[model samples]
Target: MTYVLTFLPWIVYAVLPSAHWQWAALAGLVVAVGVIVRQRAAGYRPDALIIECGSAVFFAALAALAFADPDSSLHPYSGALSSGVLALIAGVSLAIRRPFTLGIAKQSTPPQIWDHPVFVRTNTVVTALWTLAFAVTAAVLAVLAHAGQGHSTAATLVQIAGFVAPMLFTKRYVAAVQARSVPQ
Candidate 1:
């Protein structure tokens, strides 16, 4: 579990750079489901499931966008978002003050992401903000659609997926921190 948690951020970093905007989110969704199933099979409680799934899906989408350009061009919003996501990861790590020991899952740890009030509150607030961002973006899409504006709906979808990546990855970050304090 520890190794998996640690590598998730790296996975996001890798995937976002290579995927097209149109497919980043879809790819993220797939990644999230895969991780959730894996975590459940490993005997994680429901709390763990939420954190694991949310982060994986989020990171996958974000990753698809982050590395959208092989040259790592900053032209794309995905790249920008990816940067923000990385910053968030770093910030969370610093706050936790743990050097991040990987492979805690090998011991089959319990889900305790919500045990710390501060973490739980911060994560929840971030998730809520993410929801609001999604809503606003949806509104923008609806207006654009009504005005018959924009070239590719596919592209829009991909960008939206990129936005979701942060939220998902954020959740994963929270869960990983919680997992650190949880007993096996």
Candidate 2:
């Protein structure tokens, strides 16, 4: 899925040791570009353009920073920074009245319902949940990074739970709403 692909680089960066972080960052950039190319080739707008673009920018910035000062102290906070970027993207999407999830949701949604208030409202709520998740994840990661435990198992679990919780909620919430809408 697009979401999985988008997070591939982050996962790589997280799993790799600190010494190999530069390589991990580069790998993430490569994956992001590849995902964009593949999605475009399929005549589909990539599901998470904002996230992908943000990743590319982050990677590029990190690459430059590495080149400028290989020993920069900021390197350890990469995970927190990544989560913060995600939070920004989600918040901006909501502010612009174009929830990032709307595009992904539209891929499977019928054209007739695209303009429905319920459909729009559903995506808005889903987007808000995602925004909250990213914000909380960013905050937690920041705390972990400050404590010099960003790469600890506990931090990893928190990050995974942050994403998975909203994802599971979205599925269940949507299903429940749909079921309720259908006549008995």
Candidate 3:
């Protein structure tokens, strides 16, 4: 559930009316910064705040563009851009051999298992799933934006599913792995 909080800013940005994108972007930036500050106060390290950091950078730039030119041509493709940036962040985390999920998972998991192959493998797979979902969502959103349906019901559903599907997968995958590790 805590992991979902990382996406709160994006959700805020998405649900806002397109005409209010400048505000939405600014809101996202504020929320992202807030989440990071809260987490830091709670003793979370930079590794655990990877997504939050990325969100802050993305939203900062987005907010600047949104306010500087409220009528910017890129506004319509904001959803795709957001998802693509997420994909890049997640992909970079994997490339560095530090799955973004790994840091979060460690919060709930025992320290003894942090270095276990199973734990690491599970995080890797889960991170890969998120990367794939974000990539697909970005592509579909790009196409929809091009077709003038970027803010349509279908686009909203796609965005929701993009986050939800990976979340559900993470829960089930972790449970299954735990179940398999238990002695008969």
**Per-model CA lDDT versus the true structure:** 0.47, 0.78, 0.93
What order do you get sorting by TM-score, best first? 3, 2, 1
From the highest lDDT down, the ranking of the candidates is 3, 2, 1
State, as a TM-score between 0 and 1, how close model 3 is to the true structure: 0.98
Model 3 lDDT per residue over 48-160, tens place: 88899999999999999999999998988999999999999999999999999998888777899999999999999999999999999999999999999988999999999
Better of 1 and 3 by lDDT: 3
* Cα displacement (Å) at residue 168, model 2: 1.2
At residue 166, candidate 1 shows an lDDT of 52
Off by over 4 Å in 3: none
Question: Which candidate should be chosen as best, given TM-score against the real structure?
Answer: 3
lDDT of 1 by residue, 62-126 (tens): 54544564434432444335334434543443356421111122234335743455554555555
What is the number of residue pairs that collide in model 2?
Answer: 0
- TM-score attained by model 1: 0.36
